[model samples]
Target: MGQVRDQRGDHIRDQSDDQSPDESTRKETSMQDSILQEGINEVIGTTHLNAAPMGIILRGGRHTLALFKRSHTAANIVGDGWFVANLIHDPVIYVESAFGDLPDDAFTTEIIDGTPMHRLAAAEAWVAFRAEVIGESSEAYSILLTPIKEEVLVRSIRPVNRGFNAIIEAAVHATRYIMNHDPELEWLIRHHLALARKCGGEREKEAAGMVERFIGEDSL
Candidate 1:
């Protein structure tokens, strides 16, 4: 009787171990599906408000709407860099607005410049900015869409930080391509440099530098 009980226990343990990965994988897939659906809903449901000429849109209510518009515009043009930058910068504005004070004029002015450097800087600064904003603001993070296994996989809805990171990654690749062959836009290069400074993190800074080096002054 003892031997039979031991054999049954071993069998159950083996089955449980075998089932774990399958269960985990199913849960992950379901979560991914939900995320992907949310992204589609956002893109489809919202009206595209043009803060600028780009195809970006501003979502949310009137108060922070302009900021969202501007941030989206940057993201559309530059990708993740803008998202990251905005995540950092939004809190600065929030703090100023809360205290009935204004943010540094320089910071606001630089954001309008919309150069690559400025964009990069915005992305860098956004890392810290996002944390503060999340702490203070009720705004929720956005979900990300990625291609996986013949369907769009959606990851966790990140607030501005993750959204910005996503945009930065895309922008970096695009910037690299543009820098390697097309170099007439000196202004664009400067803009990217400004963006690099905003990135604040070492990896982002390095990526921005790589883009800058690729488009040398001589080439431009």
Candidate 2:
């Protein structure tokens, strides 16, 4: 039931004592995402979600990093012992791009359950992402991530609160999700993607497939 607010008064995760990035890093990240969003719109013709914002989800133990299939990225990036998650706040999604290289604009603003969420950029995050992924830091890939219903195979969709590890039901946190299906989330998803092309959780699940494949068994 603990909730925190951003400057815009959006309910994000509770503020932790961890040291936050400096102001310069924050501003630069915003600039990057804005520019990226523009490019995405132009390429996709104003409808940005034709492809969900792709992200790298970091995980521990048996699994490693994750991304959407259309992203055209490899799973080997997990070798980069570090992790940089992207937090998105839109009507439907609330994902965290666990790796820095995944792309921005995935972390911008949108109305969700009547609240607004702004963008969160990753500057030093990119540096960290490259170091670990290219560094070949570990065979299993040592990085940080969280747990949720989607786990790591969300692909293209951005994450919510990077610090908030799970997709909590509205009653659990006064946000979204109730009885496993969120009406607002459903509507928002429909808004982003055209149902004609591919639709619904069944399709998303089918697209996501097995997390282990993304983890590295099939090896991208």
TM-score per candidate, chains pooled: 0.25, 0.20
**Model 2 off-target regions past 4 Å?**
1-81, 85-125, 129-179, 195-220
Tally clashes: model 2.
14
Quote model 2's TM-score: 0.20
lDDT of 2 by residue, 1-220 (tens): 1111100111222122233435464343222221122111111100111112332322122112332212222232233122223333332232212111224464433332243322233221111122122111212222222211111222364433322221211112212222234567545433333331233344333222221122223122
Candidate 2, residue 197: CA error in Å? 5.2
lDDT of 1 by residue, 112-212 (tens): 12332222222222110110111111222222221112212232354454322422432333333342444444455466456555754555455455444
- How far in Å is the alpha carbon of 80 misplaced in model 1? 29
lDDT of 2 at 33: 22
lDDT of 1 at 42: 13
Off by over 4 Å in 1: 1-186, 217-220
